[model samples]
Target chain A: MITQRAANIAFNILVIVAAVFFALEAETFQTSGLLASTGLPSKFFPQLMLAFIGLCSVIVIGAYVFRGFAGTDKGASVFEDGGAARRGLLVLAVAVACYLVWSLWSFIPMLILIGPACALAMGVRSPWMYVSLLVMSGIVYLVFTQLLNVQLT
Target chain B: MFAGFDVVAQSIGQLAEPITLALLVGGIVLGLIIGVLPGLGPPIAIALALPFTFHLEPIAAIILLLGIYSAAIYGGSISAIAVGIPGTGAAIATVQDGNKMFKAGKGGEALGLSLTGSIIGGLFSVICLAFIAPILATVAIKFGPREFLAISVFGLVVVVRVAGESLSKGLLVGALGIFLTTWGLDELNGTERYTFGSYHLYEGIPLVPFLVGVFAVSEVLIGAERALQKLDFDQTSLTVKLPGWGKLMKMKDVLFRSSALGTVIGIIPGEGAAVAAFFAYSEAKRRSKTPEKFGTGHDEGIVAPETANNATVGGALVPTLTLGVPGSPAAAVLLGAFLIHGLAPGPKLFAERPDMMYAIFIGLFIINILMMVIGLMAIRFAAKLIQVPTTFIVPTVLLLSFVGIFSVSHSFFNVGVLLGAGILGYVVRKLGYSIAPLSIGFVLGPILENSLRQSLVIADGSVGEFFNTPIGLGIYAALALTIFGGPLAGWVKNKMFQRAEDA
Candidate 1:
C-alpha cells in the first residue's frame, strides 16, 4: 500500500533522473549534410521534450513533498491492498515470462503455459476454469495457425 | 457532395460478399462481448482484431473493425444498467439511474431505452461523420506543417487538461510519450539517435504492438488485480423492451442534444466517449424540467449517456479518417488498422481511396443497424457476459496480445516491446496517472515532431512566421481559448461575487 505522496515523490525523482540521462544522450546525436545546418538539429526536439518532462517532474515532486498530496485525494494508496499488489505484480511477471519462453523456445510452449501461469498468479482454485482457459488458448492457436496462415514459430 | 455516388454504391455492393458480411456480424458480436466485460473497451477490441485483418482486403478489414467500434460503446450500457457496474468508462454516467431502474424492476425498460437511444445517437453521428469528414478533408488538404503543428499541440494540450486531476502528471506522461518517439533513426536527418545497435529500433517502436500494450495489456494487468471481484446480476430481467414511438417522441430533445454534444466532443481530438457521456448526462440533467428525478430511476439519465457514448464512435472517427489525428484512444487503434492496410489516414486517404472511404462510412451505418438486431438478441445473454471472471480474461488477452503482435511481424523484438510497454503502462496507471495523454501523445508524436521541425525549417529563424498562416492562427486562437477561457471566466465571476458582497 504505497501512498500517493510517497509514490509521486519517488516516481518524479526517477523521472527527473531519466530525463537528465536522455538529455545528456541527446548531445551525442550526429547529423550530416545540408540538414545539419538546417533550422534545428535532431537533438533539439528530444532535448526540448526532456526539459519539459523534467520541469513537470519537478512540479509533481514539489507538490507531493510540500503539499503532502498530489491533488484532490489526501492520502490515497496506489494499490487497494497487498493482495492486489501481489496479484498485479505476479501477473505481470507471468506475462514477461511467457514472452521470454516464446523468444527462447517457441510459441506453442509459451501459449500452453500462459493461461495456467496467469491463473496461478491470480490464485484460482477451480480446475474447470483452468481447463476452459487452456481450451480457449488452443482455439486461438488453431485459428491463427490454420485459418490466418500465420507461422507461429 | 454526392459526387462519389458511384463509388459509394460499389462499396456498399461489396458488403454483399458472404465473408465480409460474416466478418461484419462477428465484429459486432465480439465488440458487444468485449464492451459487456467491465475492464475491456473499444480500443482493446480494435487492437486485438487488428492482426487478424492483415490478410483480408482493406475494405473487409476496415468494415470488421468499424463494426466492433460502433457496437462496443453501445454494449457498455448493458452492464451499467443490469449490474450497477459500467462495462466501459463511457457507461459511467448510466450507472446511477440505470441500476436504480433495474432495482425498481424496470430492467427491461431501462435496457430498451439505452438500446434505442444508442442506435439513434449512433446513426446521427454516422450521418454527421459522413457529411462532415469529406468537407473537413477538402479543407485540410491545404494544411502546411505549421497548421498541423498547431492542431497537434491543441490535441495534446486538450488531452492533458481532461485526462487527469494533476496537470503536471498528465504533461509529464504526454512529454514522455513524445520523448519515447525520438528513439531510433531521426526522420529528418536519418541520423541514428537511440537505436542502440539494434536494427529493430530503426523504425522506432512499432505502433500496433505499443498501442496494444498500452490498451490491452495494461488492462490485463489491471484486471488481474481485481480478479477476485465477482459479479451478481439478474439474468431474468435482462430482456430488452423497446419503448413505443410516443415515448421516444417525448424524449426526442434529449436524444438530439446528447447526440450532437457527443459528435462535437468526438470531433475534438482526445476528448473521447467517456467525456462526452459525462457531459451529455450533466447537460440533460441541467436542462430537465424535473432535475430532482435524475439518479432515481429516471429514463432520461439512461438515455443521455447511452446515446452520447454510442454517438462518439462516429464523432471520434471524423478526425481519425479525415485528418489522421485520432479523436479518441479507440480511434487511435483504428488508425493502426488503416496503416496496416498500407493506407495512410488523413485527407489524402479520402482522395486516394474514395471506395474504401465510402466503404467505412457505409460499413459503419450497416454495423449500427445490425447492432440493433444483434443487441436485441444479445441483451438477454449480457448478464452472463458481464459475469466473466477477470481471472480468465487476464491470461487469454495477454496471450492474444503476445501471439497477435508476434504473428504480425514474426519479430520477438515487438513481443518484447509489447511486454515492456504493458509494464510501463501498468506502473504509471497504478501511480494514478491517466494513460490517455500517454497514448494520444504517442499517436501524435511523429506528427508533432515532423511538423515542428518542418515548420521551423520553413520559417528559418523567424519564430513569428509560425503564426502567419490563417489556419495556424485560427488553431492557436482555439488553443488559447481552451487553456485560458475557463480560468479567465472564473476570475471574472469571482470579482463580480466579491463586488456583490461589498455592496
Candidate 2:
C-alpha cells in the first residue's frame, strides 16, 4: 500500500543525504594560490550545485508530506504486485552483474551475459530463446570485432 | 551566399550518381522496416546506421541517414493506421483517427491521406530548410560562448517543461543528467571532477554509447515488462490510395499552416515531430468547421498530424546544423555523427566547409523526394514489420546497441557506461520520469557549464551582466514567456469563469 508519494519522499530524502555528503567531500578539493584568488575556488560550482539539489529535495519532501495542501491525493502503489517487484529487481541485478562482469572479466563475458540475462528477466522459459540469444551474441561479436575492427578488450 | 550556389550545384550533381541513389533507397527501406515495428523510431534507426556511415563520404552518409530519418517518421503512421498500436511515439496521435478510419473500412483512404500529408509536409519543410538554413547559419556565425550558453539553457529548460507531467521530477532527472556529464575531467581546467581516479573517465562519457544505452537498452528492459501481451488487429483491409490533386489542393490551407507550425516547433530545441504532430492535429480540429468529425475518421485528421510530423525533420536540422544545438533527440544522435566525421557543427562550420552545408541542403531535398517513391513501395510491406515479436527485437536491439556503442569508441569502458546509463534510464522511466530532459540535458551539459564559467569570467562577478547582452536577454525573455505564459493564461481564464459564475 506504499504509494508513489511515500516512495518519492523517501527517494528525495536519500538524494538530500547524498548531496550533503558530496558537498562535504568537495571541501577537500584544495583552494590554492590562483584558484583561491579567483574569489571562488574550484569546489565552488560543485558545492553550489549540491546545495541547490539539496534545497530542491527538501521542497519535494515537504510537498509530499503536505500533499493535501497541494490539492492532490497521494496516488498509485509504488509496485503493482510481488511479481512486478521481483522482475524489476531482477533486471536491475542483471544490469549490475553485467557491469561487474565487464569490469572484472572482459567485454566477451559481458556480451555473453546480456541476452540470456535479459531473456530470463523477461520470463522467457523456452530453450530456443537462449539458443537464439547465443546466435545473436555471436553475430554481434563478429560484426564489432571483424567488420568494424573494434578493439573489444 | 551567391558564390555558395556553385557548391550547391556540385553537390546536387554528385547526388545524381547511382550509388548515392541506391543508398538512399536502401536506407529508406531499412528505416521503414525499423520504424513500422513497435518501439523503434528515428533515433534508433539513425544510431543503428551510424556505424555504417563511417565507410561512406559525407554526402552519401548524410543522404542515407536523412532518407532513414524522413522515412521513419512516415513509416510510424503505417502501424497506427493498420492497427490500433502506434509504431512510434510520434504516431500516437495518428492512432486516434487513423485507426478509427481503418475500423470504419476506409483504411485505404486514411493511409493515402497520411502518405500524401507526410510527403507534402516533408517537401515543404525541405524548401524552407533550403532557404532559411544558410541565412540563419550566416547570422549564427556571430554567436559567442555567452550566446551559446543562453541557447543551451533555453533548450534544456524547454525540454524539461515539455517532457513530463511533473516539473520537479523532470528538473531532478535533468539535473542528474548534467551532473553525470560533470564526471571525467573538466575541459577548461585540468581538474577532474568525479573521475574517481580512472583514466577511462578522462575524455568524459562517450556520446554514442551513452545515447544507445539510454534509448535502446532502456527500451529493451522496459519492453520486457510488456512482452507477454499479444497484439491483434484486422489487417485484411490495409491499403493506401494517394489522394487526388483536387482534394490536396482543396486542403492547401491546412497543409501550409501545419507545415509552418511543424517547422517552427521543430526550430525550438527539444520539441520534436511528435509534439508538432499533436499540436497541428489539435489546431486543425480547432479551426475545422466541423470539429465533431475530428476524431471520427476524417481525412483532415490524418493530414494534419502527418504533415506536421514530417515537416519537423527539416525544422530539426536548422539548429543542429547552425549552432551545434540539436533540435531533437534524433538530431542529437545526428550531432554525434557529425562529430564522428570530424566535422564540428557550429558557426565556424559554414565558413570552413560550405560544401558540407550545400551537400546537406541538396541531400535533404533528394531524401524528401526519394522518400515518396520509397515510402510507397515500403508501405506495402510495412504492416508486416509489426508482426516481429518483442523477443526478436529485444536481443537484436541489444546487439545493435552493443556493436554501435563499441564501434564509436572501440572501448569497453564506453560499453560499461552505456549499460550503466541504460539501467538508470530504465529505472527512472518505470518511475514515470521521462528520458527526454535527461538526454537533452546531457547533450547541453558541457555547453552550459563552459558558457556559464566563461560568462562569469566576462561579467567579473556581476549577476546583472548575464542579462546585459541584447540577444541573450531576448532569448531569456522568450523562454520566460514560453514557460510562464501557459500557467498565467490558465489562471486568468479560471478567474474569468469564477467572475462569470458570481454574476
Candidate 3:
C-alpha cells in the first residue's frame, strides 16, 4: 500500500521536473524582433508560472520530507485496499483503452464496449447491470444522433 | 444605471418566448436530477450542459445555466436530508442536522424548512444582485490593467488559501493551470510558447471542452472508483412539508443573516456555496442560545446552511457577470458558457447588452421562484437519483462527455484534451488536492497574464505604480485584511486572555 505522503512527494518531484523542463523549453520560443520590444517576451509569463510552481512544489516536498504529511489527510494510504486499487486502476485502464479504441477505429465500437468493459472492470456480477448499461448507451446514442443531430463517426 | 428599464421590459417579453421558457424549466429539472446524485455538483452540471447551449440565443443560454446553478445548490440538501451523504459539497453542512431530523421522523418538516429557506435566501440574493451588479459594473468599467491585475491576484491567492489544508499544494496546481494557458501564441507577442506544431493549439485550449473535461469527465473517473457503492434511502420520508408563516417568522433572524452572509461571501472571488454554507452554519451555531444543540437535529442548523448555499447563487453572479471574475467554481464553468456565446462578461457587457443584463436579473428571480415549485414537485422523484448505480453511471457519463466534446468541434483533439484533463483532475483529486483553485486559476490565467504585462508596461518597471489606483489599492488592502485579520485578531484575543489570567 502506498501512503499518500510518499505519493505526494513523488508527484511534487515530477511537477518540479516538468516545471524545469517547460521553463527551459520556454526560453527557445520563436519571437519577432519587433515583438521583442513589447512589454514582456512570450517566455516571461510561462517561465514565471514555472518558477512559482517549482517553488510551491519544493515547499510541498520539504513539508512531506520533514513532517511526513503536508495537508488534507496525514499519512493515509493512497487507495483503501488492494481490491479498491485494482478496481480503480482497472477502471482507469478501461477508460484509456476506450479512448484509444475510439481514436483508432470508430466511436460506435468504443461506445458499445465502454459500458460493459467498465462494469466488468469494477467486478460487477449481475447480468441485469450490463443490460441496463446497454439500454443507457442506446438512449445516449439516440439522443445525440437523432435529437441533437450530432454526427459521431 | 436604471436606464435599462425599457430594456428590462423587452427582456421580460423575450423571456416569455416558448423555447426560452421551456429551456428554463428543462434546466431546473435537469439540474435537480444531476444534483441529487452524490459527487456531481453545480460545476459538473453546468459543464455537462454547456456544449448544448451553443445553439441557443444568449438570453436563453445564460438563463438555462443560471437555472441549473441555482437549483443544483438547493437539490443537494434533499440528498443530505435523506441519505446523510451530501449530494454536493454545498450541502455537507446540512447533513448533520438534516439527516438527524429525517431519522427522527421529521423528514417532511426538515425538507419543507430547507425548501422555504432556500427560496427566501435565493430571492434575497437576487435582489442584492440586481441592485449591486450595475453599481459595481459602473465602477468596474473605469478600471484599467492595474485594477484587474489586483483582482486577479486577489482571486488566485484567496482561492488557494481557502481551498485546501496545504497552501503550497494548492498554489502548485494553480500555477500549473495558469502555465497550461500560456500555450499557443502569446496575445501580446506572436511567439509560440508550447504549441508544439499543432493548429488546434492555436486557440491555446477550447474553453468549453476543457471545462467540461475538468468537471464532468473527472467526476466520471471518481465515480468509477466507488462504482460498487450502493445507497440506502428511506422512501417513506421523502415528502416535503413547507414551513408555515410562524416557523418562518420565528427563524427570520437566521434566515436574514445567512442570506446576507452568503451573498457577501459569494461576491468575493473564488468563495463558493460550500464556504458560505459552512460560514453561515457556524455563525448560526455561535449566535444561538443553545449552541450545543446545533449538530443534534437543530432547525437553525438545517436552515442556515440551506439558505446560505442557495443565496450564493445570486451573489456569485455579481462578480461573474460584472467583472468577468467568477465568484465560484460553478461560475467558473459558467464563464465558459458566456465565452461560448461570444459574450464576454465584464463591465462593457452592460453597455453592449443591457438586454442580456435585464434577462439575467429577471431570469434569476424567476429561477428562484420556480425552483420552489419545481424543487418541491421534483424532490420526491429526484431524491431517488442517489440510488442510481455508479457501475452504469460511470461509463454512461464517460460516453456523454466524449460525445459532447466531439459534437462541440467535430475534432478528436478536444476529446484527447478531455481525457488528459480528466486524468490530471483524477490524480490531483485523489492526492487530496482541491480542483477549485486549479479551475479558477485556469479561468483567470489570461486575465492575470494580460493585466500584469500591461500594468508593467504602464508602470515602467516601478512596483509601486501597480497600486496607484484607489480601487487597486483598496482591493489589495482587503486582500491583506482577509489574509492577516483572522490570525491577528486571534493572537490579540489570546494575549488579552493571558494578561487577564496573569493579573
lDDT per residue as tens, model 2, B128-216 = 87788778888888877788888998998888888887777778777777766766666666566666678998778777777778887
What do the candidate models score in CA lDDT, each in turn?
0.90, 0.80, 0.89
Off by over 4 Å in 3: none
- Which is the leading candidate under lDDT? 1
* Residue A27 miss distance in model 2 (angstroms): 3.1
- Individual DockQ of the candidates? 0.83, 0.31, 0.80
Model 3, B140-201: lDDT tens per residue? 99999999999998988899988999988888888877888888888988887788889899
RMSD for each of the candidates: 1.3, 2.9, 1.1
Candidate 3 retains true contacts at a fraction of: 0.80
Point out the higher-scoring one by DockQ: 1 or 3. 1
DockQ of 1: 0.83
CAPRI quality band, candidate 1: high
lDDT tens digits, residue span A32-70, model 3: 888787787888889999999999989988988998898
Off by over 4 Å in 1: B497-503
Clashing pairs in 2: none
1 versus 2: better DockQ goes to:
1
Give me the runs in candidate 2 sitting further than 4 Å from their true place: A30-41, A68-74, A78-92, A95-117, A125-131, A150-153, B13-19, B490-503
